[model samples]
Structures are given as structure tokens and as C-alpha cells.
Target: MKPELISFKLCPFVQRSVIVLEEKGIDYDITYINLKEPPQWFKTISPLGKVPLLKVGNAVLFESAVIMEYLDEVNPPSLHPTDPLRKAHNRAWVEFASTLFFCQFNMVMAKEQEACDSAEQELRDKLTQVEQQVEGPLFNGEVFSLVDAAYAPLFMRIAFLEKWHPMGLLDQTPKLQRWSEALLKRESVKNSVVEDLEQLYRDHISASNGFGASRFGNA
Candidate 1:
């Protein structure tokens, strides 16, 4: 059965899985929901009340990382490293990428400059760690693994964020910069999000009316 992914367009989690689905050429369906006012059916199926719920026949899976891993496993030619230790390492880094996504969101929604500054520093620090891990031109070199699929959504958001305001988040991490460039250029990553994702981000930032919104709201 073709899996159906419940998602919110603004969700990076959904985008992560979407990239995997796209990369694997999986035939699936995606249902977009407003997370702020989620539907009754969604509330019933989702335990944590999150997006990117993978409904595969009778079984339902939540969590983007889990969904991505499941897709990789079910599909032929796994995206993870063949070595046991290396696969585990990639999984750990994918978890780290999740933290970085939250940090970037916090920075964007920060109502005060102090909060934004702190979030920026924390994000940059985390990105520096990711930089050291990059084997380039992708996360684990030429082959795009699950970890690469995981980080692509974050980089896509950062690209938009950088366009609005040049924070140089990738400046200190030349390797990540190169990695980000590669992921952003990939067909799967580009096709993962909605066509108007950037405009949606702009509207979202303006609506936020926070420190970040004030600076890039007009942009």
C-alpha cells in the first residue's frame, strides 16, 4: 500500500521525509493540515499530535526520523552507511540536525534581540560541530545518506533565512557551506517543499512580528 503522510506545509519534519520519498521515488500521498487547528481525525491518529504521520496500511508511524528510516529500509538500496558503527554515527548526527532545526526556529521567533543572539550563537556552535562531521561533498561523501536527507531541510530553511538577512551561519563552517550548497542543489531537496515556501516563510516572519520579523519582515 502507498503510505500517506500527514503534514503541515511549514513543518521541516514533513519536508525531511518528503525529500527521502522524492529521492527514493516512492509513490505516496501527502495530506496537508493546519497544525494550529488540527483536524479531529488527525488528533485521533497522532499520539504526540505532530505532523509527518506515516500511515502505512493499518500501522501509523510518527516522528520524521523514524519515517525516513522506515522508508529507507522498505525501499531498495538503503541510504544509510553499510558499516554498523558508521550507520549509528549517521543516526546520531541526524538527531543532532533536529536540534539545529529547533535552534534556527527559536532564532526566527525570538521576540528580543538577546534571545535571537543567544539562539544564533547556539545554532552556530551546533553548526560548527556539524561542520567537523562533514566528509563532503555530502554529509558522508558522494553518496547521499539518511543523514544528508535529514540535514537538507534545515539547510533549505537557512538558505531562505540567509536571503532575508545575511547572518553568515555557514561562514565558520566551510564544509557545511559546501555540503549545504550540494543539498540545496539536489533535485529531491528542491522538490521537497511547496513552490511558495519562501513566500510562506516571508509571511510567517512578518506575522511573527518578533525581532527577526522586524528585521526581515519588510524584505
Candidate 2:
């Protein structure tokens, strides 16, 4: 039986696991849930009531990182590197990448220009830290690792924001910019989620009238 993934449409964490699954050619079933109104069963299974819960038979796995690790362990072409030290290093960076998601969330929800500016600076700083460590084409040189999966969704959102808003977030970071462009064009990264994701993000910016929407400024 195919494993089941509980997801939210715009959740980057969920996207990470989905990208890994697609990359490994895993057959899986995914169902999007309303985060605000997650079912009772979901609540019972997820201690934190978050998306990206993986159900394998009667076993349930929470947390996107954990789910991805499990999938990689069970599937072929292991997404994580073979060297123990390198794998640990990649894992640490994956955690670092996760922090950027929160930075992005705060940035997206920022209503005022000042708040927005601060959030952007925070995100840029975090990305810069990742940039210094990136040896791309993929996160760990030529081989795509879990680190690549972790950062793909972040790049996805940034790509959309850049096109619609022109934030110049990646202007000074050539390595990350090239890395992101590579991820954006990847087959697994491209097909990991709903086909209308970009449009959905645009609609969200317009509807929320948040910092991302303001950046467009009638353009």
C-alpha cells in the first residue's frame, strides 16, 4: 500500500517531504487538510497538529524532516549523503533552512513597511549564512541531498516573490541564486505540489494585502 501524506497546500515543510518522495519515485497518497480545521484524527495523530504527517500502515510520522528521513531510509537513491560527518553537517543545515521558513512567514505576514523591511533583512541574513555554506548546483556539490530538498520550497517562494515583487533578495547572493534557479527547474521540485501553486501564492498576496503584495506597488 502507498503511504499517505497529510498536507496543507502552501506549507513549505510539506513540500520538502513531497519533493523527496517524488525524487525517489515513491508511490504515495496525499490529502490536503485545512490547518485551521484539521480533523480530530489528525489532531490525535499529530502532537503539534501540523501538516506533512506521514501514515505508513498503522504507524504515523510527524514533522517534515523526520518524515523525509524515514522516506529516504526506506526508499532507494538515498537523499542524504553517505559520509556520516557530511550527513550530520547537512542535517544541521536543514534545521537552519527550516528557520528561514519562519523568517519568511513573518515577512509575508508583515503589514507595515518598517516591519516588512526588518523581516526582509532577517531573511536575507539567514540566507547569507546558508549561502556561505552552499557548494551548489546542488546543496552538497553535484549530488542532491536532503539539504537540497529542505531548501527547495524556500527557493520556490522566493522565485515567485521576485517575479511579482522584485525584492532583489537574491541580487547579492549569486551562489544561492544559481542554486535556487536549478531547484526551480528540477523535475521533482516542479511536480511536488499542485499545478496552480504560483497562482495560489499570487492570490494569497493579493488577498492578504501583506508585505509581499505591497512590494508590487501597483506594478
Candidate 3:
């Protein structure tokens, strides 16, 4: 049976999962979710009420990182390194990207600019660490790996936010900046990025004049 992915068009988490599937050349069905009112059954399957859920036969997977790992296992793309230590390094970076880097950025996006500045600084520190740690094309060099897949969307968003906010996050992290620019040039990353929704959100927030404007206005 074919797999199905339930996701939100603009979600970075969902985008990561889709990039993995696309890179692996796996065929799957895509279901776009409404963040305002998701389906009742989706909650049961996802538990956390978040998107980027995958249904493969009787198994269901949530969390973009886990879902990507499963896809990697099933499809066996050359994305993961053959060396056990290198594979661990790849996984380590993915965890850092998802939990540390992405979480900090999300916090910044969810709050007012003043409240978000500190968090944005924290994000920059994390990105700086990433820059120091990773080297060569992709996180593990030349070949794109799970680390790149997990962090690419967040990296892309950092670039976008920098354009508008002028935060010095990317300025201090030259390696990460180079990696992001290179990764985004890939067809999978290009196709997976939800530019329309990203732009819509940006416009929505800008028109509101603040985070509350976007939230309350949407409400």
C-alpha cells in the first residue's frame, strides 16, 4: 500500500519530511491540513495535534525527525553515511536543528519583536555553533544527509527573517550561511519550500503591526 503524509502547506516540519520523501524518490500521497481546525481523526493519530504525520500500512509516525528517519530506513538513500560514527554525527546535528535551532526561532516568531530579540540572539548563538561544527557540502560534506534535511527549512527561514528583521544571526555564521544557500539550490528543497504560505504569514503579521495583530486578527 502507498504511504500518505498529512501536513500543513506552510509548516517547516512538514516541509522537512516532504524533502526527505522527495530526496528518496518515494511516492506518497499528500494531505494538506487546516491549522485552525484539523480533522478529528488526525488528532487521534498524531496525539500532539501537530502536522507532518505519516501513515504507512498499520504504522503511523509523527514528529518530522522521526518520520524522516523512517523514510531513510525504508528507502535507503545514500543520504545517511555508511560509517557508524558519521551516521551518529548526522543524527546529532538533526536533533540540534530540530530541538535547539528550530525551537528558538519558533519562539521568536511567536512573540513580539522586543520579547523575541533575546530569543533571536540565542538562536544566533546556536547557529554559530552549527557553523563551527559542520563542514563541506551538506552537514557531513559533499553528500546531503539527514542533518541537512532536518535543518534546511529552518535555515531557509532564518535567511528570510534576516531579510526583514536584519538580525545578525547569519552574519556570525558564515559556514551555516554558505550551507543554507547551497542546500536551498537543490531541487528538493526548492520544491518543498512553501513560499506562498510563508509570504502570506509575513504579510499578515506586517499588516497587523505586531505579533498580537496577526494572532488576534486571525482569531
Q: Candidates' TM-scores?
A: 0.98, 0.94, 0.87
Residue 49 alpha-carbon offset, candidate 1, angstroms: 0.5
Stretches of candidate 2 exceeding 4 Å from the true structure: 210-212, 216-219
lDDT of 1 by residue, 25-59 (tens): 99999999999899999999999999889999999
* TM-score for predicted model 1 compared with the true structure: 0.98
Error of 1 at 114 (Å): 0.5
Best by TM-score: 1
Task: Flag the better candidate by lDDT, 2 or 3.
Answer: 2
Q: Candidate 2, residues 127-161: lDDT per residue as tens digits?
A: 88888989877788888888999999999998877
Ten consecutive residues with minimal summed lDDT in candidate 3? Answer: 210-219
Q: Candidate 3: lDDT over CA atoms?
A: 0.75
* Model 3 per-residue lDDT tens digits across residues 1-219: 678999887678898888988888889999987887898888778878998899999888888888988888878756788999988887887888866655554544555856555666667677777887887656777888878888888877666666665656677767777888889888998878565866765655455455633432333
Best by lDDT: 1
Give candidate 2's root-mean-square deviation (CA, Å): 1.7
- Please, what is the whole-model Cα lDDT of each candidate in the order they appear? 0.92, 0.87, 0.75
